[model samples]
Target: MRRRDFLATCTAAAGAAALAVVRAGQCAQGATSEVAKYAAWRRFADTPFGRVAYVEQGTGPAALFLHGFPLNGFHWRGSLERLAPHRRCIAPDFMGLGYTEVPDQQDLSPQAQADMLVALLDRLQVSSVDLVANDSGGTIAQLFVARHPARVRTMLLTNCDVHENCPPPQMRNSINAAKAGTYDQKMQRHLDDPVYARSEKGIFGSAYMTPANVADAAIEYYFNPLVASPRRKAQLNRYLAELESNPLLAIEPALRRLKTPTRMLWGTADPLFPITWANWLDQALPGSRGVRRVEGGKLFWPEELPEVVADEARALWRV
Candidate 1:
């Protein structure tokens, strides 16, 4: 590539990355009990597609969690504590990114993601359960519910990348940027910037009750998947293609057909998905309970509003 062309591409990516974060907040200094309450189900290995690692604890009716992009179910640590005691909880790291490895041959589209999630439920003998999804997980959960309406009893969504309504030109630009080479270097450059780090305080901070956990968490847990620049390239390419292919046609058409009670949770401070997307989602789902507003919340409310999540889960499941 010509030097000028490469520089232009990098400039676009930097601009997209800058907009992606509004400002991250200062993380905390100590290990809170919220961090210790965490426990893992180990390598439980029974999935429709591949062996998956899930964090399972407490017992009652089942509640399944799907993690967002760039992070796995580990992001839902606080959500587990809130929902578990009232009901059985299982949150899995989505394939190619978390504890779950990408299957030998699996499609990365939303439909395929939905199938993988249902397979996880079936292997665990979970016929139907409540679903909570944040960020990209929200997109996956929506696809899953559309495919098998009876399988999802309820859904709580955070700001996810839903494109049925035609996302902004910048979103597409960002996807293109992520698909380009030098992703690792580009992503690191952004992560270390104070302004970059300052933005999305809600995204990383929601998972931890304290700031230290957010800071010191292993790069493997926080960034390994993205560090796989090739995979990052593939994912971004697939994602953009999915966006262009009218990929959400299946899911979008099925939203109104969804019988599962839906509650979209939004972080008021999020910049990437933004509060406006919430309005778009509400209008798309004719009967959806509308996006529940969070005053100062960013994208990860399951951490910021664990009690609210627990309350809604109980009401939805009658636990």
Candidate 2:
């Protein structure tokens, strides 16, 4: 079948199946259960990028979840649990973050991250997916759709890098720190003091809606591996430096022409990626269903608001 026809057919089938899907709240409680199983559930795929680390759940048609910067697949634990009944959910740690082991010379650019996704999906035998992404992962998702449109059945994007605003002005200092090789040191500080890590001055405070509610264990799981070794720290720095360039500019035309069904669920409180970019996306994509505002939500809200993610994914996928 033609790709467009396939997508249309899939949408219809998904809608029919969605009626039997469980309520988001009922499954949301299981999100924490997955957290404990994360280490034991973790699996690795030997891709050209490296031994890529990923976690999966559920069955049937695949749904791929791409997480934000410094976070791994664990970011999607809630969504995975909530949506597992409807789709095979897979979430992988990016090359420079989480538990993914990359070679010293691997490219960490946005384009390279997109290329890695292609390789990782191929290795998993998943030809296409319902693409769900947040933060930096949203940038890579745009690149993925532009470069491989046929591989995406639909998309659900949260606050993240958009065209021309790839490295948002607010992140200038963070990028500068990465260039100065102090980025890892800053992360070390957060790791050393979990109390401060969730403080208004720390990452969770700046990115999440409820900073103090963030657990210490989650903080360790997210930052520990990124600073585990000298090579890992250097890799993390390389990943941040790469965001300085704008890969989305060259792909704006492609995005404008894309037909993959997409929904932009943006966090209004996110200073890094404001709601304006979501408006830009609504105009850019032909298949856009329009933007949904997440009032008072921030960059990392997807982690804290999985039920919201699950609801939007089901809506976008017609399932």
Per-candidate Cα RMSD to the true structure, in Å, reads 12.0, 14.7
TM-score of 1: 0.74
Q: For residues 1-319, write the lDDT of model 1, one tens digit per residue.
A: 9999999999999988776543322232222323334433445556666677778877878888887655667676676877778768888876655556664445666667778887888888889888888776777777777778888778877777675533435456545564563334544543555243334433354333333334433333455455455665455345444443444565677886666677777777666667787887777776577777776665555654677777766765676
- What do the candidate models score in CA lDDT, each in turn? 0.64, 0.90
User: lDDT per residue, candidate 2, 1-319, as tens digits?
Assistant: 9999999999998986774355433343344444568877899999988999999999999999999887899999889999999999999999999999999989999899999999999999999999999999999999999999999999999999999899899889999989887799988999999878988899988899998667666788889999999999999999999999989999988998999999999989998899999999999899999999999999999988999999989888787
Off by over 4 Å in 2: 1-34
TM-score of 2: 0.89
**Candidate closest to the true structure, highest TM-score:** 2
Q: Each prediction's TM-score against the native?
A: 0.74, 0.89
After superposition, candidate 1 runs with Cα above 4 Å error: 1-40, 103-105, 163-168, 187-213, 218-220, 225-246
